[model samples]
Target: MLPEGNEMYRSTYEAKKAFKAMGSGYTKIHACVNNCILYRKEYTDMVACATCGKSRWKVVEQKNKIYNNIPAKCLWYLPIITRFKRLFQSKTTAKDLTWHATERMVDVGVLSHPADSPAWAAINDKYPDFASELRNLRLGISANGVDVNRGNRSHSVWPVLTVIYNLPPWLCMKRKFIMLSLLISGTPGNDIDVLLAPLIDDLQLLFDFGVETYNAYAQEHFKLHVVVLWTINDYPALGTLSGCPYSGFQGCAVCGEDTHCINSLNRISRVMMVIEDFYHMITRSEDKRSKEIIVDELDKLQEELCVTLCLLDKHFPPSVFDVMIHLTVHLTREVKLCGPIFFRWMYPFERYMKVIKGNVRNKNRPEECIAEKNVAEETIEFFSQFLKRVDNVDIPPNNHNNCGIHKGVDSSSITDGTPISAAKLVEVSAELFSKAHFFVLQNTSEVLPYIKRHMEFLEHIHPTKQNAHLEQEHSRERELGACRETITETMRWISHGPNKNIIKYDVYAINGYTFRTKAREGKVYQNSGVSVVATDTHISKEVVTYAKNTYYGVLQEIWVLDYHFKRIPIFMCDWVDNRKGVKRDKFGYTLVELKRLGHKGDPFILASQAQQVFYVTDPLDQKMSIVFKTPPKNYKDTYEDVDEEFSTIVPHNDNILPRVDTLDLQKENDYFRNDCHEGKGQNLSTSLCGE
Candidate 1:
């Protein structure tokens, strides 16, 4: 209840509810009419925008500008601290908030998770103190601008979102789980760090002095430590956030990994600079001199990053010379290791942005609309924890999908790939039933025993050698069209060429296994012998690794033969490699990308022996990456020596980075630059940061 002196809100039920539902952590700060800093805290007393010298407040006849009322613009921040606290309130989700600590498999040099990557390990080693808190919260800060104005180009809205990595994957990208933490109002601008100053300040405080909060489930209070694992964005946003060239000859956020493109003949002549073999120094020999050389070469790659920055064409904006490529990576170093590039990326947020845009009806005040929607969504999500659902999964379940574990073994499991309810193996759903029956037959030796048990169960119901009625439709069709009209007797036993038997029936009236919450996929066909693994299934047999290598199979049995009692699970897969020979099921074939993931088209893997392949099954996931080896001698370096004044003169397609950079940026125009530079549109008219 509010005090009697309070005039803004009354002590009433509606008012109290409104106050409770309100997202008021945001600070209303004034900004320059011309794109500049959002005047706040230290700049609160300042009368004008620091860069443009424009008055911070609007002149009005109604009343003198009050900090509480409408200022020049509003930067709505739903305090991250508050959001972090709420993450632990829900009993169901509270357990997931510490997944990174509880379940991240590490130490074996596997790139399966960010927690296992080299980047994560280094960060922990670097900051033992911060890493000491087993429950320290981790996050992926993702931001991108979306055209919320239908398809209008002139106006745009960029919402800065943060995903709590502490929570498991299912909730990480869900609209209800994401935090609409900061809303940078108006059309896109390059001054991100300026807008992010407040958020960063709060983050700094959270890092230094963690908030003390009681975990309702744990029943004890502990300091809630947090760290922004990494920032996620596309190339242009990465450039804007890091303050570096993201296109042109100099455009590469990772310093040396920029994809080089040749300038068209009509454009400026492009110069492709060759790089020296830093590898030779690091690997050619292991002597003291070679080690020092390796260190020097490493230093050169990191050299101010200015050498690479200086190589950009002069026509490029001065910001192109700022070599602060991927500055957000410093967080990785502090934490030890961040893992692969895609892990802490904005793809999830970019997708979730659709939900943010869907919430907007009136585009006039986009930030306000997003704020209201985010709070409401979060509240609904919090309450939904107390309810039950028959549909989509509410928890992250992965224990049901490894080795030969399927229905009958663990019948409660359900996978996404499989249908939800128990599909009975019958004539109408014949293909589905056949697939399952074959999986049980081909993968496991227990198929016969199970079929025997099944037959015994069936004899109790009705003793008969006929699902003869099931073949009636087929016989009728042949009689209607065929000249000879031969009535072939169907072998009712589990039929596989010459494999049908009297006791082992082909059609088992059984429930198709449900693995709705399993890994890789859900819903096993009867026995879950149908495992769709990647083409590289030969290497690691893990169907979950790469989609292209995936093919459905009946995982038959686990065999431990010669390799000193090693358990090996083998599959009788339907290979996409060859349909000409003994290949059984031909839905699709192997897809292989030399350097990419998605298929270019059908017949992805161009194997010459594709048609000759006969054996389709093998030990699954048996060939996963088990060794880290050095490159062969044939590995060549693309390089040449560089001078201080050397400029990489190359004309490239301007299709990159939605916006380009300018010298002044004082005039509001379409240009995007990296956020690594210290000043506005940094100008390096004379020198390129002293490389």
Candidate 2:
């Protein structure tokens, strides 16, 4: 405040004036209070609305007052062309705007982004001119009602947002990149089309003649064309935007005239296919089939869905056939028409709505509050682009942007350093040290040949012993004494095992996951839970059984064992008892009893082997919790590193749906109640029915 040569404005009026000079202001167009028409175009000079005959200005008492001019309602519209031009004007975003065309990996059966989907290819094939310019934009529109009053009163402010598919998959849906096109106050209902007219007109203009925009990266100007690829919304908003009936007999938009439903008082019928199988086919990001195969599968799924719906009609009442149930028939078609559901869904927009709602400081004028805050943030973010050594304050920096692990080298691994003073060192017992050392050696690629030679020597000596017994023998220190001299220097040190004194940490980071011990977990989000899937072998006298089993545990300590040459991190966890303490619910969620801990003797696992997970307490029982797995923040499911032989960590695929062909639904034998005994009326009713 004391500095005189600063560029900062002194007052809100001065700041607004400077921001306005930058051409980032919202244009306010008055609307009829009755939601009849907007006071624009031919109605610009009118004093009253043409359709409703209502005064455009708000009525006020004039008793020697200033009589400030005010509109009853107004729509804050941010012009689309200027925002698109600003994207290309920035060197950073200008290069990123063409990432889909230049940097995206093109694979036959993998789909990680919207551009990898069939819909993008179809657009390229049909509109060759639009595809000719890699900088041309493909957009997705999303709208939702943001509760402005925070449930204190009945008020909603709807913001129509547009997402650019030109940016990379990681940045396209981020809050800073999403453009807020229009903000309408109150309930628009069916009149949303009227409010969307201005934005639609601009889109049409952009598509017809295109806009001349400067590309900062190319150092030239090009005509930029735009197209709306799809819309993201929930079921109710879907009906509002598409003008489709979301209920009753004509609930489905894709099925059209052939919608299926049942009348009231229905009994039951056999379901044709499993609903879980249908869910598995649509949400898959990896292991996708070819276009021809997908079309054929969609055709089969459509037929199966029709029969399933008819069977559902027989079993359940008409109320059960809501819009969501009916929308399943259209899902396969939507995947064919518009990529995967994850790319074009309302989840990201719903999350962004929280940020939008947080800007409402003034409850009385929420629209104005949001508009001013948005423009301020936008101006700051744009200014950050031209400055050096400055981060865009509006966007949070990714803390989990980890690089890939190179073969046999651990330097590329990232971790938040331990405390300088509290770098506690603890000495574990002989059994604990051996288990941790053996796990690190078993998982490391450099120790594979030495392990193979040791296993072969064990097989030659113990011919009658089972492989499981030999494996257990391999983990012991006495068995490794015979071959310690023949192994390499790294393997020799690993075979001898780490010293009893090792450095211990309360927190450690690996595989893009931040882990904390149970005693150290005091934050809002829990990070103590962990899981790993490994092969379990059972050996009998005549046969052997091998099955992949998942183990869940709570992290108790983080131990980094120093092998002189390299430091290997391992976690000491209290593993939950799999047989009695763990079970899967009907909805496929893993529930574990945290109190029922087991496997105390064998508690250490390599840090690289852990797939980070968190436990949400089950509402039904406080002792139980539902497990939710987490993925890395910047992890993209692409084939960009397909040729790499070994990676420190692999993406978890435990949730991938299994390939299933058919499932049969069983029907009950008796439909009527034969035995009923409650009070005197129940027996009388049973006698009268004579079942």
Candidate 3:
């Protein structure tokens, strides 16, 4: 039968007994108060309270009424009894009686023996007088008569009272037996509600303690965050705190109000601490339960960390451009190495520059007239100075030399007698420097002799021959020919006698020929003056066309002359004379037959033909026209035979023109007629040929 304490236990025990008495082989009974208990006919089957030896019949009705009235009361000591019963049944031996007694008193309405009720008697017998004396013990008395003060002298006794009052009446009944067992066996607080109450309170206390601890931790850990917020809230406090030893632990000096500096540090520390704790906890856990607890703690810590970071961001102001730059450098190198964090740190600087650029574009703002420009200039200067320091750095061998010009001294020149000149040194340095450095120097250096030399070399090596030829040709036609013609025409016009009126000779083109004559004034032509000018109008189109044609003609002649003079034959053959002759027979007779058959009639004619054949020469008529001829043997016979011919012909041409009357009149008439048809006869034959 089951052990009895509370109503549930009593009912369960009675049911077990009834079951046993009925001769049912199924004597195993499961009790709601305790756990399942096994009973054999050979073992004891009666139900009795282990605490007071109260019979199950006496307590059963009271236990049922208590169980019906308060179900939670049944649960108070039921677990303890159930655990003990299960133990006894499993072992089939007498279990520790302390657990059973504790369950019984806590379950049923029972109290400890009189000796254990010292505080009870004081409360029951002394009443108001004892309560007044207890209040004088310096313990703070609550309105409900409970001592709330932890420092009270009677504080130790308070727990006993609390246990009794808090437990159900059924549970109090077994208190003496439970206390005895507890003293002997060292089992404490076997009542389920009593044990669980303090644990639940402690859990709440731990939570509160954690909060306080976190606040203190935040003060130390998030100093930067706190300082930055303080600075932003009370700007003057920044200067006051500036003297503090922990001042450097605050925001950036340049952009002090901005929180990026401190936030970066806080985030880094938090993430690192969390990761470290996670690893420590997981590694140190002894079992799955402990590991799970640790994991849960870590999860909570992570959530707290996230909340902290978010709060830091919300409270802290953004950094300025200058501050961002400093923050990025400091945070990346010293605080945090996260890529996203670095980018966030740099974004402010980029945005600031963009804003500055926009402000510069706004013309209405006179105050910012040069502000944007000045800032840009300063930024450039700053970068330039920074680059100077970077350039001075001696790069490691493995590092790429990005300097445009290598600044390192030439080892090759060290072996030479003379030290390399600065100019040559720069040149040599340029070869070793990186492309980035080279271009940077190229832009910055005002007098870069190396660059000048490089440009010169490029020009010299790749000269434009075709363009040079074109320029030369243009110079001869425009400057030389035009100037010479203008000067000569002016001189000629001046040499001629002037009239009373000042003459103006306007040189112009009539068709394709250049003409110079006096300008008409009041129906009279002027002389002794000439003016020359270039015009784009079609009035001078013919002259330009003629000039162009003449230029091209001269160019062609030069080419032809060069070709002919430079040409040579590959081979030559010896001269040979024709020696073969054939005799022709006249209709009269053959020569050999004529000798044999010489007749007197044809003898006179034949004899005369033979005698006067030498004198029978035809009369030759000769006419001479002016022709150029070179002196014999004056021309040299070389590979370029025609070159010699050109030299001969050119020099002789001055005297080769026809003398008036001897010129072929018919030929001149034909030329004049052709020129007339071409509308040039009047101008050419009359003015030039003196027709």
lDDT of 3 by residue, 411-501 (tens): 2211111111121111212222222222223332332443455445445755754434433333233111123343443233322312222
**lDDT value for model 2:** 0.72
TM-score, every prediction: 0.50, 0.75, 0.11
> Largest lDDT belongs to which candidate?
2
The lDDT of model 1 is: 0.44
RMSD of each: 18.3, 9.1, 55.2
What ranges in model 3 sit over 4 Å off? Answer: 1-75, 79-691
Task: Tell me the deviation in Å of residue 200 in model 2.
Answer: 1.9
Candidate 2 local lDDT, 1-691, one digit each (tens)? 5577777767999988887777577889899878888989999888788988978787654653322257878999988888888888898899999999899767565455788777888889999999999999999999889888934687888999999998876677788888889999887888899999889999999999999999999999999999998888887888899988776667766655555554545434534345555655556422322111234445455555555554444556555555566567667667766666666778889988998888889788889888988898888889998999788865676444442222222433223222111346678777777778767767777677766878888889999987778867665634444454566776767666775787777766665667788998886878888888778767665556789888999999888787766677778999999889999876667899988988777788887677777799999989999987665443442234321212222222333322222332233213322232212243221221111
Candidate 3: deviation at residue 654, Å?
Answer: 99
What is the overall TM-score of model 3 with all chains considered together? 0.11
Error of 2 at 17 (Å): 4.0
Which residues of candidate 2, in runs, are more than 4 Å off? 1-6, 21-23, 60-68, 109-111, 150-153, 255-281, 284-307, 386-391, 402-423, 441-501, 520-526, 533-550, 562-567, 576-602, 613-632, 637-691
Which is the better candidate, 2 or 3, if ranked by TM-score? 2
Pitting candidate 1 against candidate 3, the one with the higher lDDT is: 1
